[model samples]
Target: VCSPEYWVRHVREAVRFADGVRALEAQGVSRFVEVGPDGVLTAMARECLTAEEPSAPVLVPVLRKDRPETRVLTTALAELHVHGVPVDWERLFAGRDARRVELPTYAFQRERYWLEALTSFASDVTAVGLIPPTHPLLGAAVELPDADGFLFT
Candidate 1:
């Protein structure tokens, strides 16, 4: 989808999730802790809850501080503790835990030579104003098309 439609869908989904959180609050859930890579979800939850209920749950995001990758999880747990969210890290990381996993990575390979050639052709065509007047790509100096599909009488 285009940029405007993509953004509109994103906003709608966010609002729907927010509404779900509000429904949970209506059912008397007074505390929420969002655990994820970023705090975006927590922020949205906060906004949704505030809009629905003046006095609602305490929102907490586990990872808010900057730290090395190795220490980030531990730091997040500590921060959650300081914010009064109890966590059982030892149990969560008990024995036989897989320390690492492998996955394939791909590199982007495009023919820049062909891309440059196409760009040059397009620029030359635009400079000459040879494109049809009714085409959306035509810029400010577009000549209006006649009823018979010609540019002028």
Candidate 2:
């Protein structure tokens, strides 16, 4: 590949592109990352992989034509991450103020965002068939032993 004759032959002779992909697939390589100005080979790689295999390889393009470079690269990284690729986040965000946030453990489900306001039960707890909590701010009214005496929190 480094020789001048190889380059000349590469241009003059037919290139075994699919054969190279097949060879890599034979070696148990199931991930292909294309580092180029544009994702020209990605589509070709996908076509080559679809014809032969038990599993299709994940094709990732680091840079895409007519797209933001950072967004394309980030999306590629996210795809790789979803495919179980181990990324060194510490090194990736060495100089950036990136922080790890706690994600929801449960699967997020689609829910209605615009809901009608709930009727206020704070005005009267008994209306909801519930007793008020015995907190310092609010508590159930208690009758004192003496007449015309009531305790309130």
Candidate 3:
């Protein structure tokens, strides 16, 4: 996914949603639980399942954007429990003396998006196309421009 050559293909993910759902079906995955801070993917996942068939499996999200964090988690856990998935509450709460203590409700942080512009010398030069000068042909057929940064082609 880090490769720039395949970057353009990531645009098709939304279009290939049904194919992904079918692949999951082949793997016998009925329940789709997305463990994230929101339900965006869960909604799209449900849409893909419904497109293939009328029936749908248990789709749950661990947290919701609008709702309270604790309430959303509790509801999601309940949904999973009802779907015959065993939840080890004792094991989950083991060892640590974790207790709910009131703290700050939210912390606001802004994201910065910065992009750098690329500079190309050949772009400003008018060439019959590549008469582009090589290193050996620099002084022979290609004449150097008098300007400071003008590209020779």
TM-score leader: 2
Per-candidate Cα lDDT values, in order, are: 0.58, 0.74, 0.63
* Position 85, candidate 2: lDDT: 90
TM-score of each: 0.36, 0.60, 0.47
Question: Model 2, which residues run further than 4 Å from truth?
Answer: 1-12, 50-55, 107-153
- Model 3 Cα lDDT, one tens digit per residue, 72-92: 776777777877788876666
- Model 2, 76: alpha-carbon shift in Å? 0.7
For 36-104, candidate 1 gives per-residue lDDT tens digits of: 765568768877775454544566555543424444456556655665678876676679463545433
After superposition, the stretches of candidate 1 with alpha carbons farther than 4 Å from their true spots are: 1-15, 51-56, 63-72, 79-86, 89-153
- Which is better, 1 or 3, measured by lDDT? 3
Number of backbone collisions per candidate: 0, 0, 0
Q: What tens-digit string does per-residue lDDT give for candidate 2 at 1-153?
A: 799999999999999999999888778889899998998998798777744553457888888776678767877887888888988877887888998888667666675445464578656666654456568686556434212245665
Q: After superposition, how far is residue 141 of candidate 1 from its true place, in Å?
A: 55
Candidate order, TM-score descending: 2, 3, 1
* Model 2 alpha-carbon miss at residue 141, Å: 58
Poorest lDDT segment (10 consecutive residues) of candidate 2: 141-150
Candidate 3 residue spans exceeding 4 A from truth: 1-15, 50-56, 95-153
